[model samples]
Target: MDTDEQQAYRQLALSGATPMEIAQVAHLHGLGAIEIIRLLRSIFTLEFIEAKELATQAVYGMSLSDYQEKYLLPLFQEFEREGATAQDELLQSGDDRHL
Candidate 1:
């Protein structure tokens, strides 16, 4: 970012704009929207982004260590058991992949 763009970011920051809003403006100006969102997220002391409108941008392909260490691991375990049960049933039905 140039001095002018940095000033724009600073102004947006001081105005207390949400991360998503900042990202939209940054996108319009051809800025790095992801970095802008991350910067604002830090400024706002966010744990997880709740902007459903930006859910794809908020967490798409995101592999935050905390998310896996806490939320996803537990959810994965729950689904793993269900998958195991389904696999057993499919095996009884003679799945060719197992053969």
Candidate 2:
């Protein structure tokens, strides 16, 4: 999305418009059908993720970053380390098709 499109989308979203409503408004704002769909999907996905994070923070009584640092960051780091190890093994074995 360009600057104008981004501003319009942000304005519409902040005004509490739903994805479909945003798409409609964006279409009327001269965005193409594909562009509207892509923009709406991107915005919806971001909003959904943010909402989930907020819910987690509310439930845990901690900031999202704090909660993630305490609970999720280690697991993610471990997964990354394991993934790297697995990739290294695959490369060493010359079986890197998956990689």
Candidate 3:
């Protein structure tokens, strides 16, 4: 049930007309200005979404906390139960026994 206005708007849009151009075409075809603006708004929204997806794909990395959790947290936890002095003494004793 597409009307003449809808067909005119679609043809103008598919030809990549600028917003002003589309409005002019709509005016010549006896459509309201608001109707042309509404169609342009939906097209802009779709383009924005597509550009955002491409940007996300182009760059990827972990946040600082993610890096710390993966690499630093385990090492810290292992030595955390033993105070610094105790850990150093244990290492020194092990070295002496090895010698």
Candidate 4:
């Protein structure tokens, strides 16, 4: 993905946009559904890893398992659910545009 596009996605996520909204904006910018999903996953994974690293380096360091259980797991699950919804929405929108 282009750095500018990735940054735009990150900004949208930070601003609390839903996955469908992010996907819509990405589509408008010429990204297909797969590219949008890949970009979103990449952004989310990078942020998750960064947060884990920070937590590990803190004075009160959190163990990997504890961090995963308390934070990563739940967030990942939520992401999966949102991602599926976004994919469906993107596909439907694409069909509508073609028709």
Candidate 5:
């Protein structure tokens, strides 16, 4: 990293800035925003992004998991409750009406 970037990131960490926050600043300041966020979060989380590519990925859309414990599973459970059988979920959505 350049001297300026190193200094800025150190300050960001010391200030207890979040990944999302640092990301916004980097964008406003025309710095590599996404990289900053990824680096910061990776320091504290399991996520990772190469330092050089971090900035671009931050501005780009995030790839979300189709499976989430909170929403996806719960919603599926509710669907099960609503007569969405495991067998049914195994099939296409519109197949139920035909069945």
Candidate 6:
């Protein structure tokens, strides 16, 4: 997705647009509906994860650096590593067929 699509998606999503509505707007912009859905899923997933972490920090009095070092950094690294592994597996499996 392009920057404009990202901005529009975030704005519409944060403003409480429905999934179908978001899909319509995204489709009008030549973006795929499935792509919009995936983007929304990713956005909300990150928000959910961050909210849980923030709540934990509030309960434990964890410092920003502590949170980063203990949770955020490791989680991000693991996600990246997992994505890379999945990509490698896909490549090795020769799964070029589109879903």
Question: Which is the leading candidate under lDDT?
Answer: 2
State in Å the error of residue 81, model 6: 45
Q: List the pairs of residues colliding in candidate 1.
A: none
TM value for model 6: 0.36
Q: Give the candidates in order of lDDT, highest first.
A: 2, 4, 6, 1, 5, 3
CA lDDT for candidate 5: 0.56
Off by over 4 Å in 1: 37-99
Among all windows of ten consecutive residues in candidate 2, which has the lowest summed lDDT?
51-60
Clashing pairs in 4: none
What is candidate 3's lDDT per residue for 1-99, written digit by digit as tens?
Answer: 156656666677678866545545545555443444455454445454343332222222333355558778988987785666676787878864622
Please give the RMSD to the true structure for each candidate, in Å.
8.4, 11.2, 17.1, 17.9, 9.5, 15.6
Q: For residues 43-98, could you state the per-residue lDDT of candidate 6 as single tens digits?
A: 55545444344333444346446867897898999999998888888888999563
All candidates' TM-scores? 0.36, 0.43, 0.32, 0.42, 0.37, 0.36
Task: Estimate, for each residue in 22-54, the C-alpha lDDT of model 1 and write its tens digit.
Answer: 656766665453555554554455544443223
lDDT of 1 at 43: 49
lDDT of 6 at 86: 85
For 1-99, candidate 4 gives per-residue lDDT tens digits of: 778878988898899975556656766677654565576566565455443443343322455577678888999999999988887887877764522
Which has the better TM-score: candidate 4, or candidate 5?
4
lDDT-best of 2 and 5: 2
lDDT of 2 by residue, 1-99 (tens): 688768778788888987666665665676665566567656667465454444444345566688889989999999999999999999999996998
Q: How close is candidate 3 to the true structure, as a TM-score?
A: 0.32
The Cα error of candidate 5 at residue 7, in Å, is 1.5
User: What are the Cα lDDT values of the candidates?
Assistant: 0.60, 0.69, 0.52, 0.64, 0.56, 0.61
